[model samples]
Target: MSNGPAGHVARSTVRPNYETGRRGPIRTFLRSADGILIDSVYDPGAVVYGSAENPADAGRSPTRDLVFVVAHGFTGDVDRPHVRRVAGRLRAHGAVVTFSFRGHGRSGGRSTVGDKEVLDLAAAVEWARGLGHVRVATVGFSMGGSVVLRHAALHSGTVDAVVSVSAPARWYYRGTAPMRRLHWLVTRPEGRLVGRYGLRTRIHHRDWDPVPLSPAEAVPRIAPAPLLIVHGDRDGYFPLDHPRMLAEAAGDHGELWVEAGMGHAENAADDGLLSRIGRWAAVKAG
Candidate 1:
């Protein structure tokens, strides 16, 4: 719930800005609970430790105590510009961790879509905690959005805050053309070739043995953890009803923001919107 026991670690003006003085951006391979290799990156923002207490840092978010683990959309990896941009914007508010799900990018295995991706996010969150950030938040886009909600529900108090952007409310949604195309890509053998060589995403052929919990179904279980549901009014992949369903399931614990003229996933997210999200995560997670 409320940032666990370290929710209010005494902000001392003494610690060093360990994020800086490091050799380079933190990049490493992490192992999921299921032993899958996950490629992860950590971007330490330019803010120094204890800087939040400075008079000059008054208006801006100086969130050294928080880390945001960002989950990319379907076919997305940590290397993609859109995913990197999301990491860049989030780092302004705190340290950021970005990772490629299993079967995406250089990672091993095939994408089970939103089902097993929860393990990938869990691995990233564990790494964030290992980095010494007491508070952690997860921000996911589209497919990744579904992963974050399910991750929160399954992992319980592992994450302090959760933000799902442009995510579908349920699984196997074939309402939109994009959704239909996506299903074809995942379900068909030839389409799997397109996903592998064309999209650089290795999609699993087997269907979910047991369907994982849907985003809307998982929302109620994420209660007490700060949850933010964001969608674009003009999103092509999933309409406003998707976010509405998730928000309704969240009841009083979740916050919703519907942007005007926005599209879908990370690409549709602008700098201003990302900045607002970063600020919200900092405040809520801190």
Candidate 2:
């Protein structure tokens, strides 16, 4: 019940400036786990060593460390630079495998925000687990962060750890004057009308859910397994306190990273930030 409907947490935001690098093509594969045919894709340009072609090459070695399952934000595809950057970073650290969430890229199903997406995350984890990886961690950006939190909360003892960047706990809240003004201006009558029937609708898929899955509500349950909440002090959509509130809601169960000038998921490569998360996951999974 941490970041749930009854939770009280102030919202905040930072300046909005996003940039991503040109990504190479994706390596597609169809793998079945728990009866779900997960459409997994990876950056071929990011391939460090070994070949995904040989089934043995894909299998994790007994000495293999940990595998990271990367999830991207809303309206994000696997080809996005942010996704690629994170995957590239993890791969450089020798992550076993990485892939996008269901319905985001070549994956199947309609976006359910964090609702059904949690199941997709579970499937992805099960896929990695089946591959002989001893420990697993998930890194999610924006909406994907919420999905990761929900998955961790539900499967607390199962997952090793979780990291959420620029993920909002309360969907509706005002943290700063500019953020409040922007929220009112953008979510007002015109915004509502547009979202309802306009050309640029926020919820596009027919299966989109109106109810936002409050990850804060799920954070408390993600204990035992470490959780890392990373957010930009300069995020535009959600405020800084959103992450703070999520951290507080998580009690002593998790750690938080409040970067000074980071924005949403689409920022430059912050190897330090990613390294901190990587270390945290490595320690937790170990």
Predicted model with the maximum lDDT: 1
Candidate 1 stretches with Cα past 4 Å from truth are 1-24, 48-64
TM-score of 2: 0.69
lDDT of 1 by residue, 113-188 (tens): 9999998898889877876778899999999999999999999999999999999998878889998998889999
Alpha-carbon local distance difference test for all models: 0.86, 0.63
Q: 203, model 2: CA deviation in Å?
A: 5.2
Question: Across residues 1-286, which tens digit of lDDT does each residue of candidate 2 receive?
Answer: 1231210111212211223232232343333232323345432223333466765556333224477877777656666676766776766543534554544555554444456667666765665664445788888888788888988877666678788888888765676574476454344666435433432223324433556458888898888888888888878778777898899999887888888888776453387787777767877775
What are the TM-scores, per candidate, against the unseen true structure? 0.89, 0.69
**TM-score of the candidate numbered 1?**
0.89
